[model samples]
Target: AQSVTQPDIHITVSEGASLELRCNYSYGATPYLFWYVQSPGQGLQLLLKYFSGDTLVQSIKGFEAEFKRSQSSFNLRKPSVHWSDAAEYFCAVGGDGNNRLAFGKGNQVVVIP
Candidate 1:
């Protein structure tokens, strides 16, 4: 079984500042990693994902994530976060043989001026 852990439970970042969120996973084989963001009254949105090939993947809204197999980590980063970016972020791991994904506790991001 695969599992994901997001170390930060809550994060506060200033508007226009860079933001990074840590994610670690434990799986026997190559895992499918995903970063999802959810805003108040909105459904979960796919930010980025990793399956194979490139170690780094880019997504919508200027979000990117790098997959580091050696460290069992897939961290998400944004160069300059906007107020709209303030939301709940979740890291999930699955794939290979697993059909279902396991998500982390989630990180609540609050953007301030």
Candidate 2:
């Protein structure tokens, strides 16, 4: 079975400061990792994903993630976080051929001025 773990449950970052969220997975084969962000009353929005090819992947809103197979980690980062970036971020792992995914508990980000 595949599972995702986000060590940090809550994170505080100052506006315009860099932010990074850690995600670690447990799976037998190569896994598909994803980062999703959800605002206060909004649904989960895809931030970035890693399937294959490149180790570093970028997505909308200046968010990027790197897939480190050697460490079984896929961490998400933003060079400069905005106030709008405050949300709950989730890390998910899929690609088991069953189209199922295991998600982490999530990290709640609080952006302060």
Candidate 3:
């Protein structure tokens, strides 16, 4: 069985401030972790992913994630956030040998200018 958990339900940050969203996952085999962002009333957009090699992967809109197998955690970080970055972010783990993914409840971010 596999599951993802995002400890933060909501986060608020001022424009140009740093942001970090926590994510933890449980998987039996090699885990494929991903971060997806969804704007208000919009579909989810792929942020980044970590499958193999290098611990870090970069995605669209200045987002990056690091995967730690030992800690079973894949946290998302942005050096600086813009007001338009406000969205609901989800952390997901891919099924072993399958394309299916199990996503967390999501962390909602609010940006203030």
Candidate 4:
């Protein structure tokens, strides 16, 4: 069985502050991991992914994450989050194919100015 769980359902942070979102997964083998962001009433955008190489992976919008095999976790982090960074974040895992993706419910991020 393969599945993903994000403990936090929502998070609020002040602009220009560090941010970290947690993600946990349950899978039999090494799995393809991904982090996606979606703004209110918008589609998902890929933040980053961990397939096989180095544990740390960087994304487009100044975001990065580390894949911890032992913890069965792939948590996302940003040094200084921007107001534009406020959005819903989802952690996903896929293997068999790209056809389907199992997504965590999502963690809504609110940025206070």
Candidate 5:
């Protein structure tokens, strides 16, 4: 069985501060990892993905993630978080190119001025 778990349901951070979101997974084989950001009442945008090769992958909007095979984790990190970055983040695992994705509940991020 493959599953994604986001331990933090919500996170609050001051604007312009660094941010990190944790993601852990359980899969029988190598899984396709992805991080998506969803604004309020909008569709998800792909933050990054880890298929193979490089363990460290960069995404748009200055977001980056590193795949740690030993830990079965792919954590997201941002050097500086902006007010606009305050949105729901979801971790997903793609299964067998079926176009079906299993997503974590999501982590609500709050940015304080």
Candidate 6:
């Protein structure tokens, strides 16, 4: 069984500050990891993914994430966040040959000016 845990349910950030959303996973073996963003009324958008090869991958909207197998963590980071970045962020884990993804509850981001 694979699961995702996002410790922070809500986050507040300044308009130009950097951000990091933590994500942890539990799985029997190596699993696929992904980050998705959803706006107020929009569908989920893929931010980035980690399938194999290098642990670090670049994502859309100046976002990036690193996969740490030893720590069982895949954290999302943004060098500088904008007001437009305010939304619900999700972390999901799939693979395992089941074609299923187990997602975290999500992190609600609020950008303050």
Task: Return the TM-score for each candidate structure.
Answer: 0.97, 0.97, 0.95, 0.94, 0.94, 0.97
Using lDDT, give the best candidate's number. 6
Poorest 10 consecutive residues of model 1 by lDDT?
93-102
Please give, for residues 1-113, the per-residue lDDT of candidate 3 as tens digits.
78999997999999999999999999999998889999988999888988899998887789889998889999999999999999999999996677789999999999999
lDDT of 2 at 71: 97
lDDT of 5 by residue, 1-113 (tens): 67899988999999999999999988777789999999999999888998899999998799999999899898999999999999999999876654677788888999999
Candidate 4 lands at a TM-score of: 0.94
The reply for model 4, stretches above 4 Å from the true place, is 97-99
lDDT of each: 0.93, 0.94, 0.92, 0.91, 0.90, 0.95
Give the alpha carbon lDDT tens digit for every residue of 19-39 in model 2: 999999999998999999899
Which wins on TM-score, candidate 5 or candidate 6?
6
In angstroms, the error of model 6 at 47 is 0.5
Off by over 4 Å in 5: 97-99
lDDT for model 5: 0.90
User: Could you tell me the lDDT of residue 7 within candidate 6?
Assistant: 89
Which model, 2 or 3, shows the larger TM-score? 2
**Model 1: pairs clashing at backbone N, Cα or C within 3 Å:** none
RMSD of each: 0.7, 0.8, 1.0, 1.3, 1.2, 0.7
Task: Enumerate clash totals for all models, in the order shown.
Answer: 0, 0, 0, 0, 0, 0
The residue-level lDDT of candidate 2 at 96 comes to: 56
